[model samples]
Target: MPVHQRPFLALGLRLGAALAMSSLYMLVKLVHQMGVSLPEIIFWRQAGALPLLLGWILLRGQMWQLKTTRFKSHATRSLMGMVGMLANFGATILLPLAVATILGFTTPMFAVVLSALFLREKPGRWRGLAVALGFAGVLVIARPGAMPISPIGALVGLASGFMVAVVSIQLRDMGRTETPLSVVFYFSLVGTVLMLPTLPFTMTHHTPLQWAMILAMGSIGTLAQLLLTAALRYGPVSTVVVMDYSSLIWTTLYGWLVFHQMPPASTWLGAPLVVAAGLVIVWRERVRARAAATPPEESAPAGRVPRGR
Candidate 1:
């Protein structure tokens, strides 16, 4: 089947993936609160996923999928991804879940600008407008003087989104030649290696319950990433990404239930605007994709019959 043909199914998968990710972040925040350092969390997170990913490749007899000429590119992508993930997790730990998640929504806006700069894909007027409106929503959420949210936390969150956007660019470049499995495996591998040295200092003794939560966080996060990758492979990023907004819903619900923290009025006010802008951007993308897929009009000389005629 054509990749874009079953977008609704892809949408479901993306939404599910987002929910899983939201849950994972909540767990990460819980463990961090329990005195786990970021490096240790990242190490176990990457390490936990390694076995499942490798097992999948083995079971599917797709070990050759690991072969690639793009090792350098993969390393670069992994480095960016690790930094982005850490920043995002840090924001999650430092800020209220809802606020951090709203800031994370800025990724699409950053992706629009980055695609124009790095990939030479110009976002047309509609998308440009969407980016502006999205940033406006960000400004509303981040009205720094009032101090409803920490300026530093907000900045870190936005930086995380920006770094994730950079990773997206590298993923796009890598997607041209590499399998998604290969890309994910290398990311986990490199991320694990990068976090390993710090693990000595970062590690701490844990109770059985704490250990279980840590393992669960890593397993869920890894599966969520795989689901997200598959969702995009089966659908356009525009379509799949719209479903990611549902993460806010998951985070909001979980934040209240688990942490007893409700989002302030500003978050409620700003988040929908950002989401609306993102949806508009997605609509524009779909229109553009359809236009690109369409054949241009063809005409015959006035005196001649058309082939179908």
Candidate 2:
């Protein structure tokens, strides 16, 4: 099947990625609450995932494909990715899971705008409307005028969302020439190396359970990253990323079940608008794909019968 025809598959991968990422965020929150510093958490999240990523590459016998002329791109992506991770993790620590997750939904809005600006993927009228609706839903949920979140946390969360959009555009470009495994592997490797310098300052002894949770963060995170990269590889950035709004469901569940924190009534009120926006994009993409795939009928000469008729 053509790549453009796989929106359903991309949607599934994106939804799975969302679930895995929300779980990772929950773990990050738990570990941070248990006294792990942000730098230490970042280190473990990347470092722990590196070996697993390497093993996956080796298992697929694609180690040789890791070589690329795009190291500069990889470096830029890695740096942006690390900054995004820090802001995302820090937000998770500072805010409620639902709030952080809702804030992250801004990624799709940014992705749509950046895709138009950088990737040159036009946001048609439907997509533009969907992004606008999604943003309105986010405002309803965030309720800046009434919410009690720290201003710094809100800024960091927004930064994370913007960086995520930037990285998604980078990945869309990179995916053209690099295999998904190569992109993910290099990110883990570079992230691990870059974060190593902070170990001396941030490392601390952890109980065995804490260590297990840290490792789990890495494992889940690696899976989420791979799924996300593959989804972008298989679909348009704006279409695939809008699916990330699904993460709010998983994050809300984690917040309720694990942290015993219920989202405000505003969340219930606003979430459907966000979800509806995603559905609009998905429906529009499918329609567009079908229209592209269907060949136009040939016109007959004037006063002449068509060949078959």
Candidate 3:
């Protein structure tokens, strides 16, 4: 079946991805509190997911598809993605779940600017306004002068968002030739390899429960990645991307229930603006896609009017 035929399924998958991601963050915080180092956390995240991904690839008889000619591209993407993951996890450790989640929402805004600069894709008026509004929302949430949260956490979260935007741009080019599974597999593999040397310094003793939580965190992270990939495969970008905002709900609930933390008043005030900006960007992209797909009308012959005229 064609992917665009399953918009509702795509939506459900995207929502599931959001939930999984929120759960992963919560678990990361839990394990970190148990004395897990950042490098160990990152290593477990990638190492644990690698086997699951491998099993899925083999079970689907798609191992051959993992072969790629763009080794350098994969390496670059994996490195950037690992940095983004580290920053995101680090932010989760330093900040409340809801605040970290809100900061991560800046990705689309960054993507708008990055796209214009690197991809040479013009943003036009509406998208330009959207980018401005998104940044304004970020300032409202951060509230620099009267900041109550960790400034470092806020900066790290924003860095995560920027790296994610850069990775998104890289994916745009890679997607032309790479399979999603291969992209994911290589990312996991490379991430694990990159984090291996740190094990000697970062690894610590863990109880069975801590070990279980670490594994669970990695498993949930893999699930989120798979769900996100599947969502995009089954739906148009406009339909799927909007569902990313649903993470705000999941993260908020997790923060309140699991961590006993609530978003500040500024989060309540600024979240809507960021969300609205992202939606506006998605809406514009959908409109542009539709326009591009439309065939141009035939011009009237010479000076003669055509048809009803």
TM-score of each: 0.89, 0.83, 0.89
Give me the displacement of residue 197 in model 2, in angstroms: 1.6
Compared with the true structure, what per-residue lDDT tens digits does model 2 show for residues 215-298? Answer: 999999999998998888788775777668778888889998999987678877776776777677667666766556665553
| 1-309 per-residue lDDT for model 3 (tens digits) | 233348899799889988999999999998998899889999999999988888988898888879999999999999998999999999999989988988888888887888789888888888899989988988888889887688899899899888867876666566667777888888899999999999999898899999999999999998887777666666665667788788888888989998899978998888888888889988887777766676545344566653310
lDDT of 1 by residue, 219-251 (tens): 898888777766666676766788878888889
Instruction: Evaluate model 3: give its lDDT.
Output: 0.84
State which candidate, 1 or 3, has the greater TM-score: 3
Higher-lDDT candidate of 1 and 3: 3
| Model 2: per-residue Cα lDDT at residue 79 | 92
Clashing pairs in 1: none
Prediction-by-prediction clash tally: 0, 0, 0
RMSD list, candidates in order? 5.0, 5.4, 4.4
In candidate 1, stretches whose alpha carbon ends up further than 4 angstroms from where it belongs are 1-6, 59-61, 119-122, 298-309
- lDDT of model 1 at position 108: 83
